[model samples]
Target: MFAGVDIGGTTTQVLLCTADLAVIDSTEVSTPAREGGQAMVRAALDALSVLRARVPSRLLGIGIGAAGVVDSRAGRILVASDSFRSWAGFEVTATVEKALGVPAFLDNDVNAFLRGEAAKGAVVDEPYVLGMTLGTGVGGALRLNGELLDGPHGAAGEVGHIPGFGDLPCTCGGRGHLETLASGRSIRARYGERTGRLLTARGVAEAAADGDPDALAVYEAAGAGVARAILITAGLLDITTVVVGGGVSRAWDLIQPPMLAELTAGPPVSGHPIRVVRARLGSGAVAIGAASRARTELDAVTRV
Candidate 1:
């Protein structure tokens, strides 16, 4: 058995899986985002204990998918969003290993999301791909030749922070980032700016579904921004296969038309048509991907 944990800003999910990564049991807990790293880990530990109690197999190892720039080699979070207090610089894998008495591995949450899709979800078995997650914030990851690439600074596929989308300020203190145009929070803010009503992203989607021109325009702009980012990635990396996920992607009906239009308008120089699809694993992707990572690491250690 192996344990997979995904620690998000609002919730922490834990999954117990077999050697092949089939989930045997799972649980979730509210994350103490403002309370500090130790509290958040404790919440994950508590949920993990519940799952472990339900499963009879001995856990072989653990893998953690956390929201931040992770140093996979060091099993630590190098940088995190402002939503998490004291998350950056947290010794995640070490602390979890000490608490659970097992070998552990860690990676950025977006990386894990892409790995999950490549392993068993939408882009299963694909060699080269780009993954985007448009939640409260946007995140990205790259997979090439069947392996995820984590650059020296662990920010190789950080497409959200790249500038030139618009003049809006990003949560990372940058201006003209893709996140400002495509993230869930940004969608809501954009809609609120158009009409003085502050609606949630979901509400805006609902309004768009009802043919509200303002809402439609907002989603179209977001789709265009996303398309531009995808095009930039394709041109740079020669990766035309893209998979999108996260809360904002739920409004695929509202976002896809303009995105496809933009992609069609400017074909890549390589002439390869871009293929974009929604994630299939839903909210379970991170945990499953984490378990897959644990299995891979454990197998490597055994060979060594």
Candidate 2:
């Protein structure tokens, strides 16, 4: 058996998987976001303990999909949001391995998401693909030739941070980034800007569904932003298969038309049009992807 943990801003999920990658048991717990990195690690460990108690199994190792800029080789956080106190520079993998007495592997959450999708979810069997998660923040990942592409800087597929959005402030303190217009937070902010109504992203989507022109316009802008992001990625890597998910994606009905419009507005690149689709794995993608990362690493060690 193997263990997988996905540590998010609000919750932490732990799952147990069979050798064949079947998730047999799972548990979730509220994340201790303000308590610092050590507390966050403890939360993951607690979730793992819960999973083990539910189903007795010998875990070969643990894999973690954590939010932040991760140095996967070091198995630690290189940079992170202020959401988690002292999260940056925390030695996650070493600590987890020491506490659990088992091997552990860590990766950026979005990278893990793509890994799971490529392994068994939406983009299964694809050789090259791009993935985005449009929730609290926009995240991106790339898979090249069936492998997760974490470049030397560990920021290979961060399309959300790419520039070209025209001077709007982004969550990362940057201006004119894609996240300014496409992230879930941005959608809510955009609606508030138009009507002075404070509503969640879901609420804005609901308003759009009810034919609110302002809400519809917000989603349309987001759709255009996503389309431009895809085109930029396609132009650089020539990988046009995109799998998107997260809370914001639930508003696909509102965004797809504009997104598709922008995608085809320009001539096809290399005679290949973009093919974008929704992620099928839902919230479980990160955990499953983390587990797959652990499995892949184990296989690599065995061969060595």
Task: Give the whole-model CA lDDT for all candidates, comma-separated.
Answer: 0.91, 0.90
Task: Give lDDT for model 2.
Answer: 0.90
Error of 1 at 60 (Å): 0.6
In angstroms, how far off is 60's CA in candidate 2? Answer: 0.6
- Number of clashing residue pairs in every model? 0, 0
Q: After superposition, how far is residue 163 of candidate 1 from its true place, in Å?
A: 0.4
Candidate 1 lDDT over 1-304, as tens digits, reads: 9988889999888999888777888888898999999999999999988887778789899988999899999999999989999999999989999998999999899999998888789999888899999999999999988899999999989999989987999999889999999998999999999998899999999999999999999999999999999999999999969999999999999889999999999988799899999999889889888988988988998999
Error of 1 at 131 (Å): 0.8
RMSD of each: 0.8, 1.0
TM-score of 1: 0.98
**Residue pairs clashing, model 2:** none
